[model samples]
Target: MYYSTDYSSPIGEILIVSDGEAIVGLWFYAQKYFMAGIDDTVPDDDLPIFKKVKKFLDDYFNGLNPRIDFRLEPKGSEFRKKVWKILMEIPYGETLTYGEIASKISSKMSAQAVGGAVGHNPISILIPCHRVVGTNGKLTGYAAGLDKKKELLKIEKILS
Candidate 1:
């Protein structure tokens, strides 16, 4: 069963889901692919994981680089999980093109395929999917809307 809670963030209302321990999903309300891998959920605003995620969002909006102390268990294909892990390595104020991510995975990997994985990222800001861009540093689609992605980059000082 999934334990869930809601958090009001600067970008939007986010639903944070956990298995009572590890965070399994977090998405902006009504975002594309929101809760893509989750079901059988019930709200529990006081779940410890929810409290930690709330604090993380609080510190993030307050411009603090809060450490990810709580556990995360985002569900996805192995390829997608690998892509998300590389996204986590992107520095706070930097960006990586989808092609770059593809190269990291395999020179044989296509940017479009990487884009697919990037676009399906369920954890959003915590997984740093906003840091992924198009070639030549152009803005591209984001599951939570490009506007939210831009706002997040602005907060990261990657965009001004």
Candidate 2:
């Protein structure tokens, strides 16, 4: 069964979901694809994983550059999973362009396809999708909206 808890972050309310052990979803309230793969959940709030995630988020919002110490099970197609794995490689305070990610996948992989995968990423901040920019290094197409994206980047010190 899926368990959930709400976390209040600097940006907004975030719903954190877990399939008992691994983190399955974390999304800003009302953001695109919020709880996309979750069907139902019991609001537990006391799970160990939830505690760890809350602490991670706490350090993250406080500019501590917290490490991803918990297990993640973001559900998606194989292609999207590949893209998210690449997204995790994006260092904090750095950004990668869609074209760059496409090239890593294949010389011929379209930037648009990479964009789609990034857009569907279920675990937002932890997955680092906000670190993706357009070809011109301009911020664009965050599922949580540009404002949240900008705030997250600012937290990562990527934006002044």
Candidate 3:
């Protein structure tokens, strides 16, 4: 079974999903691919994971880089997981180009491929996919929309 809750964030309303024990997804309301591949969830505002995620987000938006220790079980293939792992390594107030992520993973992987994986990241802010940018440092390819992406980066002080 799946549990779900909503968080009112500075950027917008967010829908957080959990598989009882670990968070599986967190999407901005109406985001592109919102809740993609998720199914049969019940409202569960009291899930411990949701509360922890809320606190994590609260700290992040409040200009604190709180250590993230909550369990996450985002569903995806090996390649996507690899990309998401690199995304997690991006510092709280830093950004990386899609090509940079591709080169880190494999010389054979193209920036387009990395961008595709980043675009599909289910955990959003927690995974830090919003930190990926164009090679020239222009923001791009956020499933939650670029404006929201900019807001998140700005909150992190990555964008002035």
Candidate 4:
């Protein structure tokens, strides 16, 4: 089960969904409402993970570098996990091209494939999928939208 909370942010209102321990989703309202068919069920309230995740989000929105020490058990295939792991390694205030990540993970796969996997990433900001950009340095398909992506990059000081 998942529990959700709404937070007002500089960019927009965000809906945070968690499974008591790990945040399952943190989506901007516009993007979230656009995909209306998906379920938004909240899990039980007694889980410690929910409180930890909520605190992390609070610190994050307050411009504090809060350490997110929770385990992220995102649902995905092995290849997707590999791509997500590479994304996590992308330090804050930095960006990487899909081709770069693909080459780093396995030169055999195409960069486009890596981009597709990234696009489908369930955990957004926490997974840092927005950190991935075009090889030419242009922002690409961010699930939360490109404008939000640009805003997040600017907030993180990676877009200056």
Local error of candidate 4 at 24, Å? Answer: 2.6
**Which stretches of model 1 miss by more than 4 angstroms?**
none
Highest lDDT scorer: 2
* Candidate 4 Cα lDDT to native: 0.76
- The pairs that clash in candidate 4 are 2-42, 2-43, 3-42, 3-43, 20-49, 20-50, 21-49
Per-residue alpha-carbon lDDT of model 4 for 1-160, expressed as tens digits?
6677666777777666776666666667767332233375754545676567668767766666677788786667899889998998988778999999999987698999998889877766778888899968888888778888998788678786
Q: Say which prediction, candidate 2 or candidate 3, comes out ahead on lDDT.
A: 2
For model 3, what is the alpha-carbon lDDT of residue 91? 90
lDDT of each: 0.91, 0.95, 0.91, 0.76
In TM-score terms, candidate 3 sits at 0.97
Query: Which has the greatest TM-score?
Result: 2
lDDT per residue as tens, model 2, 1-160: 9999999998899999999989999999999988897899999989999999999999999998899888999999999999999999999999999999999999989999999999999998999999999978898989989999999999988998
Tens digit of lDDT per residue, candidate 3, span 1-160? 8889999998899999999999899999998878888877999998888889999999988989998878988899999999999999999889899999999988898999998999999999999999899978987778988899999989988888
Worst 10 residues of 3 by lDDT: 135-144
TM-score of each: 0.97, 0.98, 0.97, 0.84
State the lDDT at 150 in candidate 2: 93
State candidate 2's TM-score. Answer: 0.98
Error in Å for residue 143 of model 1: 0.6
Which wins on TM-score, candidate 1 or candidate 4? Answer: 1
